[model samples]
Target: MRKIIENYGSILLLLLGIALGSVIGLLTPHAVEYIKPLGDIFLNLLFVSIIPLLFFAISSSVANIQGENKLGKIIGLMSIVFLVTIVLASIATIAVLYFFPVSSGMASAGVMESPTADNSSWGDRIVKFLTVDEFNNLLSRQSMLAFVIFSFLIGIAARRAGAAATAFTSFLNAGNEVMKQLLLLLMKAAPIGLGAYFAYQVKTIGPQLFGFYAKPMALYYGFGIVFFFVFFTLYAFLAYGRKGPATFWKNNIVPSLTALSTCSSLATMPANLDAGKKIGIPPAIANVVIPLGNTLYKNGSAISSILKIYVAFSMLGWNFFDWNTIITAIGITVLVTIVAGGIPNGGYMGEMLMISVYGLPNEAVPAVMIIGTLVDPLATILNATGDTVAAMLVTRLSNEKFAPSST
Candidate 1:
């Protein structure tokens, strides 16, 4: 019991907070006016942190990409594999959500603030979504897409400048650490913040708030299991035909367990590297891929991002079937899952992206942040373990026998 708490104490505390708040809200609906502010304050603290966090983390990760010393076939192959896998993962999520749709109806739908419809042309919307008119505008949450684009450019510029940008790179690295620490400090209040937030939601929206999650939560976990066994097997087979699936599965036990137990992709690296070597991924490939994968590859987050977007859309009373929305959701999934997955509390950053991109009200984030949290354990398994399989796929395509320094 003590061991279980140590591993999962935070999640348990969050759930307990939610339970207590739910009881308060349901028993005394009038308490919302008093408790809602706590949730709002917490959410604001998170929102305030995202811009600087993304600016530092994304730029630093891109600037410090390990493959710069030797980037040719292997790096190219890794990029293809990462893009293909994340796209496939998002498509798989879209298909599942299409069939077993998440519940959307809240008894008090008015509790959610809806964005006013923008009847702009697709071209205009695209430009608006991806760029800000003024530099100052980029700092606001509404310009998250623009800010992300800017960060990537900054990182690329720094990388290209090499020795000239050493000081800038150091600053980015330091800033990333500072932002991570700040977020960690802030999250010490999650149990209270999320609990109060949920309480306000339950009181305003009624207890059906829990029911709204029942199907989607169950479906996410259920699909994660199926995706792990089924799609991962398919990826493995593609990597090393016939015996590949067995080999991949047999070797991944430690990495998978490490991912679950430690909940950190960086923590699972040694085991993942060992698993890749056992599966015959060349050192050149495994060395670059596993470390880079922690920062840029995330099959698990792809699915989770898509689900969070869909749930936010559903709650906002938007049409999920709209072609524009579907395309945009997939695009957002690839960006957030890969780019944002490296940082601490990145899920919340990703949620902020969704809310900003869709013009959804602030309430949408709290609604989806819980889903991100609950799904994280399973998500981390796919993410950490998938790197080895990805390395195999790269190996299969790049030829089986290669020098260790071929990368």
Candidate 2:
């Protein structure tokens, strides 16, 4: 039906792209390599827009937080909840790994020379993050965290600009809207671009990639499902007591499914907004929190980060169980997930951070990318679901009526 197609057209196209790419790679890999450039071009286009988009979107959101009373309280509560969820996700990842330990053989046996490895201590890494050249950092993907920090500060300054804050916030908001429109336009080519990319990926890595990672991937998904049910159930109970569980699922199933199909929290925002209304969340809270959570609240991403770190350390024959390493991994996972964008393959940025901070082998970069891409949809489902639950909690804590009483 036209309605069904309209509702799910993008996801269908992406799925078709993936399928076609796999077939081409399997049957005529030599020919498929020629089209790989299309995928690269698409990725390049996305990378080009990311920095400005981050600045506008993140800064504007933070700046606007000043306009609403108790919005800060909502944000404060949400922050604690978000951090708790991420920590829980990390704990789940650790527990899963204990039961289904990743084999060392998942890593390529060949040794790779890492060009980015350095002798910087954790303190040095922190100092470097806070001391980057602002203009230069904005122009480079390698300085994403630094750029994020700069954006946050700029947003706070804009918020405190008194009467001038309104115009500044409007300008940044317009820019953010324009960037999102640009991304949507580029996504129209996703079928062709992502298909080509996947074809080349299959050709280069072959089926063996899946075979080697099967157990680990399975473990990730299994634990992810457990986390989703456990956390959301508890969140619902806390927000609305007995009726909360049913209401949460009733309203969120569609949004969760949309996120799963698109692997994009940003794309699922409209549906989430509608779901928030149906569940009695105040429009003011939903407007602020859903968008903010899209960019910052990434419990799913935190779990993925933790999983990737575990795999990377296992590959490198490092002691993952050491207290120091465990604590450091938790810190890195929290930070990286906070900065992860809501686009497909957005976690690639976080993976890069992991590599730089943890001294992971350069070869592990590609492996992490591949793994993250493969699991993006499920991760996104958890992310979208969490956003809705967050809205519920915000509604409860702010003591707002869910819906207006019939006049």
Candidate 3:
């Protein structure tokens, strides 16, 4: 029992904190404001750490990589896996909504304030989405995708420079280690940090969940549970057959809980990175894929987009099943999910896409946006932990010989 506790201490503590916070939120809904700041401090710490962590982790891994083609192959396979899984998530959500359906007759919903709106052309928005206007913009958490691109470029350039860049490579590696240790120290506070955040979330959002949001929330969460357990299990199995699932589940627990509590993919990146190492993925793949996944991965985003669209349709009395509308909505969801994660105000951007494409009223934005908020915990779990499994699949497909847990 002592040994078990020793091994599982962090997760046990995390779960306990979450349970306690949840109870507090439920029993006393009026006090989350005081608790919310504790959570914010933790999240801010995570956000601040991410840029350096991405820079070092990705650049160092890529710089240390041996064969040039190996990196290319890993990325190619990783893209395919990301796309396939996202499509599956989106389609699955559509299927469930077909059977279960999500309608609230609350088409008149509107927020006290409007979401951020960008009037830029699609071509311009796409360009800005991937590349920033200046170097300083890359440092912001909002420009994560751009920073990832910058880091990847730095890695590729360094790798090409060969022996000339060896000293720089060492610096990158050292920085990665330092940032990782910092993350470890940061995680020591997660039980309190995330527990506080979860309390606020439950207190503020709990009542809404029980109201008109219940039906769609139920549908989203029902599918989320299946996707988290069943599909993730299947992906693990495929990555290494029988041994894969056990390895994944073992290393994945803390990351899963972290995502559930914090509802932030970037906040969960360190745990995913650790899990990737334990799961035997090459650092080149894990470093690039996990961080990149935080910026661009679509499993959770895809499902959320679909549900948001369905809710709007059902409320507006439109036939969501219209083959053309379904096709169009799914396409929009995929596009939004793909591009939305990297930018500031991404959720608002996604809402904009849904409203514009479906030609819905502005009021529909807040209605569906709440769904994203309510479902964020599970959605983030899928987004963050899915990166670990993705790295496994990429390793296998790239011929890297990843045999489950290495630890």
Compared with the true structure, what per-residue lDDT tens digits does model 2 show for residues 1-407? 99868656766787787788879988998888588888778666756776676677567767777454555777787787778877877887877787778774566733334335456786886676555855775666556556666876787788778677788888988987797678668767777776777687667655644665776677778888888888889988898888888778867765675565456666556557657767777755665567667767887888888888887788777878888888888888888776577666688767777888886767677566667776787888887668878878877877877782111
* Candidate scoring better on TM-score of 1 and 2: 2
TM-score of 3: 0.94
Flag regions of model 1 displaced more than 4 Å: 1-70, 105-212, 343-345, 402-407
Q: Write the per-residue lDDT of candidate 1 for residues 295-391, one digit (tens) a residue.
A: 6788878888888888877877778878899999989887776555433235665666676688777667566776666666678888878888888
Report model 2's TM-score to 2 decimal places: 0.67
C-alpha TM-score for every candidate: 0.59, 0.67, 0.94
Best candidate (score: lDDT): 3
Best by TM-score: 3
Worst 10 residues of 1 by lDDT: 106-115
User: Who is ahead in TM-score, 2 or 3?
Assistant: 3
